[model samples]
Target: MKFYISTLGEFDIKVDGQSILRDSNRMYRIYKLFEYFLTFRNKKLLPETIIDNLLSDSESEDPKNMLRTQIFRLRKIINALIPKGELPEKYMNLNFTNGYYCLEIGENTIVDIDVFENLIQKGDKEREYDIESAIESYQNAISLYKGLYLSDNAYEVWLVPTRNYYQRLFLKTLNKYIDLLKRNEENEKIVNLCEKSLLIEPFEESIHIELIEALLKIGQNKSAMQHYEYALNMLEKELDAKPSAKFINYINIIQNYTSRNNDLDIEAINKSLEEELPEGAMYCSLEYFKFLFNLQKRKSKRNNEYDYLLSIMINSNNNKSINDVFSVLKKSLRKGDVFTSWNDNQILVMLHNVKENGTETIKERLTDNLINYTRINRNEIRLIFQPVSMENTIL
Candidate 1:
């Protein structure tokens, strides 16, 4: 019987087109054993190594005995996959010889990870001679990576290195494939490929850069700008760091793209620039807020105006969502004020031209509005204010 094993994104064993091993709480331990064995099939593994990797956290007094019991259970499960009359030993073997245990499977079994590596090798070999053939091989290999390796076992410490290795290999192969496509002037294909790769590696700055470059190549300037904003926000929010210089350079490219469009009249340009029925306070991206804050600082110094930066820190245990607080801020503040989420539990607001005493009054007003709108206790919200100047760093 043919055994098809999948272990890249998930764990599964299909015998002759029938799924036998499934994800279930009752069979988790046994399934993990089977998966580990299958991953290192035909290799002699010592009992100590297996126990340390699999049962290191267990409270059992005798893990060796526990391992034996689990192995026996796994053998039963494997035997059930064989035909009614065939001997299970002919198809699979879990044997302990000397001081090591080994799992041997018949040649009929096919594993996805093996196939994925083979395809990558094939692509590399063909890359020097046949670009088209190499691209096809790389595409097939990339398609096999549905997600991170063993994504279901994300929290397993032993799987971390293996997972990172596969992910790096995937990103490397994908970048090579994208380079081949770029050489062929296949911008559309590069766009599609990078977009899909982003789903698998969303935080990968290189993939985002590739996608934005491809979009720019196809003259999709607007789409490129939109993706730039998304990438910027994602990096800031998820990683708590600014993007690299290579990524920040895209903003200049986008600006150049906009400046090249000379077909519009002054009236149309003004119409496009105007906001539709301006609301209470303007909400901007953190990056844009930084620029505004800096500009306001310079203006405040020159005009001798009193501008304040107010920070609202929300308690983590509050029942109200951060969005609820943001909504209230958008309506409660004046039209000249601006705000952005400083972090997961905090927001920073720029209050323009407020008198020394106005800080207290505005703080009270916002506190009251938040309490009334969110019905949250006053103690759960903390607001701090400082004059907007060169000394203050909002970013």
Candidate 2:
């Protein structure tokens, strides 16, 4: 009998290459219990710890009895899937000894997560000496991580630490692999790997930077800028933060790659003339927004005044139009504040002379007003603040 367990993305169990878990007749709790034991395999877990970890917030008062019942059911499920008389009494059984429960793995059992960790360990060791073998190992390991560990177990506190650990490891391995590829000047391979990596880690700003650089190296400037815009919008909306200084500088370098204009004043004057000047909360194009952003940078430098940029985005699932949200913003912002459309789904507001604390007040008031006036859910709106510094430039 062969038992294979997969805990990434979905929790699945296969016996003799046949899936035993089904959608309509799913045993969610039993599966979760089995997963918990498998996760802490070979460890002595107290009944209280298992109950707290697996059955927390439940209405059941007799958790120990409940756990015993579930364990019995899990064993039944496992036995039904496997051939009779295949293993000894101890093998392929959830065992209890000395008031501790453990999943006693049989010799034939293979867990995807276990294989994944082993491959990662192998890749790390081989990466020191053999690049190709390490890359292969990493690729195999990453493929097994189809998505987050037990993605269906989102909000399960016990899973968070392990999930985060694997996610970080995956990213570290990916970055190392990309670096090795870069050493070989494998630009196309870099592009493929980065795109695949972004599927698993879309919000990884470092990967976005690498993707942009890889695209640029292959004369894909248009694609690179599109990805930059995406990274900027995503980071701002999701994290309320900007890309790192290195990422911003790299973008600037890409833009000015062929420029011969060493004169700063001439470039500044030209840029200023090209921007659509806004007195207060006026709508403008993204291009104009960039120009105004630079203008604000200069102003902050000259007057040593603190300012902040706030981005408002309407969730696509909402029925509110861009103009509808813009109307609310125009009425809500102060007279010195300038606003522009960053994208069809996003609005950029430069809140002038306001400290970080002031931005909080503004956000609160804006949230209240928008909720009071609009039929949209509060979650359908996203507001991101970009703090300004004279020493740095932002887009």
Best by lDDT: 1
For model 2, name the residue pairs that clash. none
Model 1: how far residue 299 lies from native, Å: 40
Residue-by-residue lDDT tens digits, candidate 1, 93-179: 788899899988766667888889999999999999999999999999999998777777767777788788888899999999999
Q: Residue 206 of candidate 2: its Cα lDDT?
A: 86
Alpha carbon lDDT of each predicted model: 0.80, 0.73
Looking at model 1, report the run of 10 residues with the lowest lDDT sum.
269-278
What is the Cα-based TM-score of model 2? 0.64
Model 2 stretches astray by more than 4 angstroms: 15-18, 88-91, 258-395
lDDT (Cα, tens digit) per residue for candidate 2, span 208-263: 88888888888765556555654565465445677677766675765663133324
* Residue pairs clashing, model 1: none
Instruction: Note each model's CA RMSD in angstroms.
Output: 13.0, 12.2
Instruction: State the lDDT at 341 in candidate 1.
Output: 88
Residue 390 shift from truth in candidate 2, angstroms: 44
